[model samples]
Target chain A: MQIVLAIVIGAAFGAVLDRIGATNPTVISGMLTLRRIRLMKTILLAIGTGSILMFAGQMAGLVDVGHMSVKTAYVGVFIGGLLLGAGWAASGYCPGTGVCAAASGRKDALFFVAGGLLGAAAYMATYPAWKASGLLDGIAGGKVTLGAVPGSKFDGLFAISGDLLGIVLGAVFVLVAFVLPDNLTGGKTPAEVPAE
Target chain B: MTLDWKLGGVLLGLVFFAAVLLVKPIGVSTQFVILNGIVTDVVNPEFITQTDEGYTSTNAYMAKSNGKYAKNAANPVNYSFIFVLAMMAGAALSAFGRGLDREDKRLPAIWKANFGDTPWKRYAVAFLGGFIVLYGARLAGGCTSGHMMSGMMQTALSGYIFAAGAFLAAIPTAMMLYKEG
Candidate 1:
């Protein structure tokens, strides 16, 4: 039953991603280069919308907070994030979008996927060394939410309810998405390219 | 017709909401880990059980119990795997419906324009990038979707911090590589 639902939801998510031009490497790279803002707007809007919905759901008791899979913060995560960023700039596809791009018939994306899997395998192969390297050892906070802070849910950082803070941030993202020009810095829109 | 991203974002949020409501948070990195486990199991059955020091297994997550991979509640071939497959199917369907599937260009225009027409260079860079991304994602315990999106939704501190790191690196790295030529 759960498997069937996953399939349905996954398809819907993929379709949305593709529709938003995420499956196109040019758009992705363009966003990174500041040559285009459409994809950026889309991403910000999606994240913002998701953030609002999630917190709202939690507040309304419609969603289980425990179901949220929060990752642990560590020095390695920060360093690894930098590496991932460099990789994203070079390749133009992140893990999820690479799969979606491949499915959309991008041959290069297939190679990207192969590279990712091989990289993952390599990590597993060298797990022992990495584990002992102390890079994975220092964990800052594990599974902590804004609500966990004292005084108020969002009092720690910005001095508001954590959930409200998320919503406000989300609103800001959406606002930016709206305010930004379609071609902020001007670049070839996907429509300008001849269909292959 | 291009779908409005705002609409897409809203719809995606709803899908995510429904997903969390019905099953669990959405993520793709773990699927790779599970795939590696399955491949390793097939190549050398004992490799998975072997420990880093022979006393403690290097990958306890891949350990089997009663002839089944016992870490995640949903087996590799089950939930996450199927979800990935469905994502592919959905992308393909969308492409087909929009008549965008006819394009057979093996390389993206921007890549070819800036990096030159060589296929090998493109492939090597892509492969290296993919490898590094996955390695980083694994080390960090999640990818953009798993940590940045889902975690941030719940107002988790880790999510914000990770996002900060990702953008902090990604923007400059991109600028360095694809600088105006």
Candidate 2:
């Protein structure tokens, strides 16, 4: 039953990703280059909406903060994030979107998926070495919010309330999503801009 | 037809909400790890169990039966894996419905425009990049969807920090790779 639900939910999410141009490598790479802003707006808007819903749901008891799997803060996490970013820029596909693109019948995306799997396999093969390297050690707050805020039910880095801060930040993202131009340089449709 | 991004974003947010309501948070990287576990277990069950250290520890989620690496389809991690399959099906459905798969060329035009026409180079870079991203994601404990999107939604500090780091590197990397011709 749960697997069925997961399939439905995943399908809906995938459809959304495709519709928003996320399945397109050009759109992703273009956003990184600041040549296209549509994907950026989409991402920001999604994050904003998600933030509002999640935090608001928590306040309303509709969502459980404990259910969310929060990652620990560590030096390696930051460095790894940088590497992930560089990889995304170079490959034009993150893990999620790569699968989506492949499903959309892009052969290049298939290669990307194969590469990702191989890469992951390599990582697994060397898991012990990485573990011993101390890069994965040194966790900073295991699960934190903003500012180590007080009177807050959730963990954070700041002294502000988690819900309040999340909602405010979400609103800001929504605003920015609306404010950014759909296309930075303009005039060409997304499809027309690439591979004529 | 492509739905507007704002609407798509809203729908995606709703999906996240639904995921939280029904199961654990949404993420993609762990599925790969689970796959790795399956592969390794098949190749040599003793490989992962040889050293009970770090992630490879016997009690680790991937090594245990009821854990993320469970071969059972009903397992939660496997459910996440199923979710990835479902995502692909969803994208394929959308593409077919929209005639997106009708295009003859598989290679992205932007890549060719910038890097010239060499399939080998493109594939090589793609494989290397994919490997690095997965490696980094494992080190970081998540990817954009896991750490940045869902993490931020939960107001986790690591999410924001990871987001900052991702953009800090991504923007510059794109600039360096795809300069104006």
Candidate 3:
């Protein structure tokens, strides 16, 4: 029952992402280019909204916060973030968006997905060699939470509180959707678009 | 016709509900360990050791110190990992079914000019990018999934910082690439 629910929910979220023109490389790239802030706004809305809901749910006893996982590795995170950013720029798709794009039938997305899988496989293949020198490993902190790590818990509380903010932001996104006309994305190239 | 909001909504609802029901939560970082186990099993059996060092057992360094594989080969595809994979697949199926399957060809002029005809360059770039991301993900102790989804869900401070880190890198990389394009 639970697994079935999981699939159904994920699929729906994917659908919304697809409909919103999120899976398109052009749209995501546009966010960076400043041609379109839609993607950025949506991401902010989702993060802001999602966090708030989760917090509220936990506070209400509707959700179990302990089962949730969190870890802190400042060095690894800082570096990994740099790499992920570089990759997203060059590839025009992150892991979530790539999957969504592929489903939307983009050839580039297929490459993106293939690359992710192969890259994952590659990481595993090299883990042993990388691990041998202890260059990649660091002190393991069990499950550091807002309470455990450095930094004010206020921000953590703010994230949950942001749920109310998400409502306002989400409405704004809808407004942007209306104001921005379609074909803001240039149409398909001659080769990509099928001839009549 | 109404954006299938009902369908999308129901599915998303299910994701949250199901997560709470089964895995007690959902996350993506564990998938890396499973992949590591599978790849290690196939590529280098000698890499895995046999020892017990608690959570450190999963750390590449501690694994070496304790004499065990960084990822427990005994259970590579843990139920949680499988759940994450399933979520991706489920989302794919739903989106693809709606006739939304098409690429947006908003290529930056440079890429279009230099490698427009060839897909391999982009593919190579994508592959290279993944390598960098995984190495980072491993070091970060979690990918976007574990940190963003699970960590944030728990209201952990690191989750927020990691999320910020991902965006911080993402914004600049996007700027450079798109500008070049």
Q: Pick the candidate with the highest lDDT.
A: 2
Count backbone clashes in candidate 3. 8
lDDT of 3: 0.51
TM-score of each: 0.86, 0.87, 0.66
Tens digits of per-residue lDDT for model 1 on B1-181?
4567788777777776777777877888767777776676667665445334332223543442332333332245587788988988998898777766333347777776777777778778888989988888877767787777776765666677777878888887776777542
Candidate DockQ values, in order, are 0.58, 0.60, 0.31
Error of 3 at B127 (Å): 1.9
| Candidate 2 or 1, higher lDDT | 2
Please give the lDDT score at residue A40 for candidate 2: 86
The residue pairs that clash in candidate 1, if any, are A153-A162, A154-A162
Best by DockQ: 2
* Candidate 3 stretches greater than 4 Å from native: A1-17, A99-106, A113-196, B1-25, B42-77, B100-115
Residue B74's lDDT within candidate 1 is 26
Greater DockQ among 1 and 3 belongs to: 1
Off by over 4 Å in 2: A147-154, A183-196, B47-77, B101-105
Q: Rate the local accuracy (lDDT) of all candidates.
A: 0.71, 0.75, 0.51
